[model samples]
Target chain A: MVEGKKYRQFRVNKHLKRLMAKHYALGRYQRYWGRPLHRKLAWITSGAPVELLRAFKIYSVYPEQYGAICSTAKATEKLCQAAEAAGYSQDLCSYARSHIGSILRPDLAPMQGLPKPDLLVACNNICGTVLKWYEALAHLLKVPLLVLDTPYLPGELTEHAHQYVLEQLQNMVRQLENLTGRKLDMQDLKRQMARSAEMTKFWREIRELAQAHPSPLNGPDLFIQMAPIVAVRGSQEGIDYYRKLKAETEERVRRGEGAILEEKTRLVWDNIAIWPKLFNFTKMFTERGACFVTDTYSGGWAAELASGDPLESLAATYTNIFLNRSPEFRARQMIELVEAYEADGFVMHSNRSCKPYSLVQEVIRRRVMEKTGVPGLMVEADMADPRAYAEESVRTRVEAFLETLQAL
Target chain B: MEDFFVGVDIGSLTAKVVLVDAQGQALAWAVDRSGYSGRDVAQRLTQEILEEKGIKVEQIKVTVATGYGRVTYPAEREVSEITCQAKGIAHFFPGARTVIDIGGQDSKVIKVLPGGKVIDFAMNDKCAAGTGRFLEVMAGALEVSLEEVGALAVKAEEHKAISSFCTVFAESEVISHVSAGALKPDILAGVCDSVAARVSALVERVGLEPDVVFTGGVAKNAGVAKALSEQIGYPLLIPENPQITAALGAALLAWGMG
Candidate 1:
């Protein structure tokens, strides 16, 4: 206790309890760090791949996820130092820098008996930083490496990409055979993809189910749906999982279930999940009985677009959807998702680390409002880098946003 | 028996390890998803290979680490990615003076001076538009895996380049191409042309040389590497574990570590 300071420790905690409730993290902080799977070491991580790892029960670490973990508990500075020592420029990806630093210095990125990954996996879908970042790591580890490839299709994926991609898929299938020493049965693979497609359809239908006077789906459940969607997207398990989800949702609608309290507003949310703190985001609305009618994840079901045409469908998959299209297409898709789901407002996550996606999000937001008259909120945060996420500021913004929506 | 050395490159997407004798002769290599424990991953993989070859870890002269995990490696010293790449490339193709290394996390164009010193370099570590990870994610958008981008790109009938450097914009463009009824192979070829064009532009930024060697993980892609080679008017000298060039350079640096 400072003798002359009546308020040294009393700083900032006052206003934080006030308006921060609206954007206050509504999710519980569950510890995911524990015993890992019986597996090889090494982790190739992008922001979204963290969820994939969780689904596969893979014991890997994502530096951004670690940043999220660190920020929630306040340990980013030390990690930052370690990265600096590794000769990694401080200006690079903060998450990557922190992770690299941790790798360069063990005390910072400490884990239990850190084991190396047998393989590394990365998809350039999020950003290009990962490839070179991984390139360096692959060399240091000297482990068999694998990379998931995507061609840049800024305006639209050409029809040629379908065949191009299919051929690549065949190659990947072979690569997997070499890696896992487990054969991917054609029947099983097809069944998995079909199931995933089916689940996507069911989830899409459930998103539609929210069109009633009171939506059948709530924010809480809306967030949980991402699991099957992400974990089993190209496999049958996702489809089977979504089937059960759709059935239960149908029953919930039949029984007059409202996910949130009073079920008054229909909101459309566009952006990636703050997985490190998802429950908080959902709780902010669901406790209010606000049904989140639509999201990009709901529209991730282009598998049916190529239904029965796996090879061709796979090739054509990325080119046919708004999610994979230009910002104009995405703008239009957001407009449509709002209309189809009859959302009353829009919540757009302006994630910082993901500048590419968030770049035109404002344009999309304006277009959506002009096209649909639904107000949108541009909630900013790091896709996964905790340093970029301003929880207090976002909470304040959301609270005001909901107030305005309620006034409407 | 001569001393042996090991190099490991741990990236955001993949982990790779390479083994070499004192002469820098490539022995064994592995690539895997790095869960954690990159050091153990490196040590164990090296051990497994050595054991298989009836050798021991101590029998090896030195170990070096590079990529995103170089310094933290359980080794004597860590070298800059640029330095390691120069060494790795020089070892593979003695005549090489320039190198283009595209990995999941970053893309680098290096000007290798005589004696494996990096004279100058340019790198794109921010966006995926021109890096390997871009192709990885686009694979999903294109409905393929990371490994298949090259072959698919080779099938393009029309060379329509995907012009967007931004992945989001590219997504929109890819969808439009698909809906417009363009042939899948043609579209894929366009993307390949686009990626190669971006890479070529980067390479040109640092000034290209007569003999350019493409290192890093992407060099293994027969399609894209070949496309890159054609675009640059030179043959790409890719090592068996092309991704490990940076780490091998670091491992080779072990010779200087003491």
Candidate 2:
């Protein structure tokens, strides 16, 4: 079947669909073979330390990704209502609220909801909301919860912060050992970290391929493709997938093929993808030949993993995740993206779902515009919930921002 | 042969059309409630204005569409109201460094550059609290006309405060204030002050500049203009026909295209 002309199809989309299908299938039927294979299925946050869990032969499931899937399935409003009925505040993170709703009523959820987890792991490096979210999950599922708290870094990494994160990681190892009944193998962990680092590097390189004129990739492509790196990091399958993507992307760049037919203006995107309307909303830019070459959202997975002892390296790497940093750090990162990609302008998604990413965006927007002399636009919407999206308002702001670039 | 340029602005509550000649002089313009169909209103008004001026459609060199319903119009080109407002204000006041536009559904604060381009801008979130709609709703609740609210508000010697920034909540608050024996003009003054406070927050986001140009339907309200000036610490320069500025900006852009 042919796709619509409104969007240019990516060559590797079929492979991604197959990979995600197989991954979800494995999780859906995990109860049948998981116990025999001695692999415990665990629910985890997107920013949690997955390598440590992988070393114990644990299968990881990302509730955040599943929440996005539910949104794409157009089941978020119903699922969120279920959660709200159960006393969860509507003001809470939509991902968490929806996931909680799915948990309370799996019959109304997609795929009859995710398989029941044997345990839960959460890291506060992403946002403080995860701590409370995972705590609720742990209580409901009656599973042990492992939390690795990464203190917010105002500026440079202090010695106390390093010791604090490393100490918690060391304590987490004992809990994992007790749960899995496996000893911590230093060699096995080293191998996992190495694979994880290589996979992250591959992603970083794939993003750089977009630096080519008429970028080989667009925003939706990046948002969709970065899933495996988050879901199955520290695994050979994830690395292999990225390797093929890198090679394909490089080929596209070499041939001067772009994600869109013509790239008249290059833009940088901030915040998370509007999952429910990803294709529809992105067409607003691609149809105008304004391609989003890079984004801060998916780039969160491409941060280089530090090299050192396994626990200490994980501490340094995960603690400094972009979402946990100060606004100055984010501003500098955005300015660098504008300069590095030769971006004509940038747009900030004032996402209502994620406050840590959305708040202080105006300040950052001003700083980037002042530094780059490129106009910045703010579009208010939610990452997963379609209800928050105001189509006409977003269209006006984006159309205006694009016109500003054309005038330039 | 006469060369004509046209600009059409289709907002949430109203639709406006402006026609200009090759030399950029206004030929004819019209404003009416946008009603249910922005596309229909824009098409009909453009036709009426052209016919009223004895001009043929073929004489139009270019047409630019703007405002909330901009994309729905089949003009030669479409632009953002921010850019259109900046261009429109700059055409009249060459020194306009800031623009505060309070339309029916949304409010915008734009920082204008030297060439009539928008350097940066901030807009109200998905709410009607800080916009012209808030005032219109308050006027209805007070049993006063939209035009009378502003004029009557200026008569209040001591203005009371309306604490809520939400339109629905503020409506109820206004009702209770009236029941509590608060003067009608004082409550109206408070409503204007509330809009000014909300708009001030948006303006602060973009950073204020001197020679601020205030345009849009709300600019005709002396109460709002006065309160906004007090909050911004500078008197606003409202255009003679503030409601048609965005449409004029679109016409100016159309002329530039020609």
Candidate 3:
């Protein structure tokens, strides 16, 4: 277990281990079963329409998720160095750099790098970096590449923007049909969407249970528990895993147990997990009787699938991701979270690797603090790269933030 | 004997110790280069101050530590410099709403309440550009003593503009000015301007409020002080001993603990 000292380990973690282990094991040995079944493994982004890929029977693997794994495993620095040695700029997204580094130097990578892909799929909803990242992967692995171009939503999702994404979804279906030599099965897609919706609902409900007086979940729990939601969405295994997790979380709430031993200050987190320092960094808070009740990153998956026909829903859901929205929208989202979770304050990671998420965070933080009358702190660090983390500086900021909250 | 409280602020470049009595009145304070071990320097300073004041070690009821070396220092409590600074400022200027503290390695702007509670804050992110270290580097390049930087800078008729935000690049900018036969005071004024510009951006993050109190070691620099006041369009309220405010704040908090 990756659980740290003073942390309450969820019993469902065992089920999660078995579930993720089986998932990775299947991918690691995909050649044996996949070739016989005419299934092709496609490297996909975190924000891609995985339901559509699952419907086409395409085995989807997430390099971004693997980047987090490499980080937690403590192999990201070496992998990122390897990528940097190969002319990738140090300023690029650490996940992209680490993943590309894994490709270039598998010996230095965790799990000897993610299994080779038959094709690469990327969606621009998260960031434009994924498109270039997938393109680089396609070049290196000689695989077909498919991209979903979701327009940025400065305001609400316009009808034309929705139609544009829907058109791309249609085109992607045609491409998948040509690649897999299979017809578009509307029934299969509907079934996949249903499972996806169910899994998303369970994840959302589990997170909301933290609204209990003493939060049942902490930052690391949210980050670690989000794996299945990101990697195995729309799958029965994912649904089962979340169901078990939801029940366990509810039990903790019923018993009034916090993820930490003593919950004094409840906070909301912004940006991706500092995967390398997840436990170590969070320990600074947990030891001080602080618990991150909710966060924006893991909650990204908790959003319900958009309401529409399957294709239209996929287009809207994928296009309207929070990262693609304006700062005002994100600020309101944070304000609502602070009110709902009863958070004393919020901490934004200001992740150096995620421009879209971190760049506008100062604006959002000001708005949230102004609206909610709560303070927000920004800690600058990369989500995957350990090089960018300044331990002393981060500790100072965190301690000061908590001190202010306690003073209030 | 009356109870005495001690606050130690072991910063990156300096270690300071302040002693206060039962009623939160400052009795004695000392400052010295942090050198190889700030904690050791702080301990030595604390011992000296207590001995000088004829107070025994047992008479010290509470000890609080603040700043980068705070965690390592053996104290009754360790508070962050931010909270300490705000408390310190509030003690001296209760109406102060904003604080701009540029220390050895990091700079921060804090918005505080009436009683020194931090409402919000913003600090320079993993960069030495807007800090005292930035000025030290420019001074080293200009062959000027750290103490003389401010005095010399204020003498310049027109300040040179040091455009680079990176300390190393800004140092080179200083060198270029020197090599170009520009006056030393002009280059030094530019250095002050550069630090002020960088810190002003941090101030904007938390926002500039009335009765802005500027503390930290850099607050002693007259040139940067003048530039910052003009840039932010508000006069700064600097303490008599700017560097010891956080230590003073720590001492006050220690007294409060009693």
Name the best candidate (by DockQ): 3
User: Runs in model 2 with CA error above 4 Å?
Assistant: A1-7
Candidate RMSDs in Å, in order, are: 26.1, 1.6, 1.4
Write the residue-wise lDDT of candidate 1 on A121-204 in tens digits.
765555667777777678866876666555656676665765676676567657656665555465554554455456667766
DockQ of each: 0.01, 0.83, 0.95
Candidate 3: stretches off by over 4 Å: A1-4
lDDT of 1 at A260: 53
Tens-place lDDT digits, model 3, residues B1-258: 899999999999999999999999999999999999999999999999988989999999999999999989999999999999999999999999999999999999999999998888999989999899999988998889999999999999989999999888888888888889999999999999999999999999988889899999999999999999999999999999999999999999999997
Give the per-residue lDDT digits (tens) of candidate 2, residues A1-408.
Answer: 135554456666677788888889998888898888878999999999898888888888999999999999998998999999999988899999889999998988999899999999999989899999999999999999999889999997777999999999999999989998888888888888999999999999999999999898899889988988988787787888888899889998899988887889999999999998998899899888899999999999999987678988999999999999999999999999999999999989998989999998988998998999888889999988888999888888887778778752
TM-score of 2: 0.97
lDDT tens string, model 1, B1-258?
668877777765677777777666677777776668666676667777788778777777777666665546776645456667788788778888888988876777877767676555555534676777777766777787777777777877676568898888887787788888876667766766667888898787557896788877777776678678889888777777787777666666665442
**Overall lDDT per candidate, in order of appearance:** 0.62, 0.90, 0.94
Error of 2 at B67 (Å): 1.9
Q: What is the DockQ of candidate 2?
A: 0.83
> What is the full ranking by lDDT, best candidate first?
3, 2, 1
Could you estimate the TM-score for every candidate?
Answer: 0.47, 0.97, 0.98
Task: Give the CA lDDT, 0 to 100, for residue B237 in model 3.
Answer: 96
Candidate 3 local lDDT, A1-408, one digit each (tens): 244567699998889999899989999999899999999999999999999999999999999999999999999999999999999999999999999999899999989999998999999999999989989988999999999999999999999999999999999999999999999899999999999999999999999999998999999999999999999999999999999999999999999888988899999999999999998899999999999999999999988899999999999999989999999999999999999999999999999999999999989999999999988999999999999999999999999999988852
Q: Could you give the DockQ of candidate 3?
A: 0.95
Best by TM-score: 3
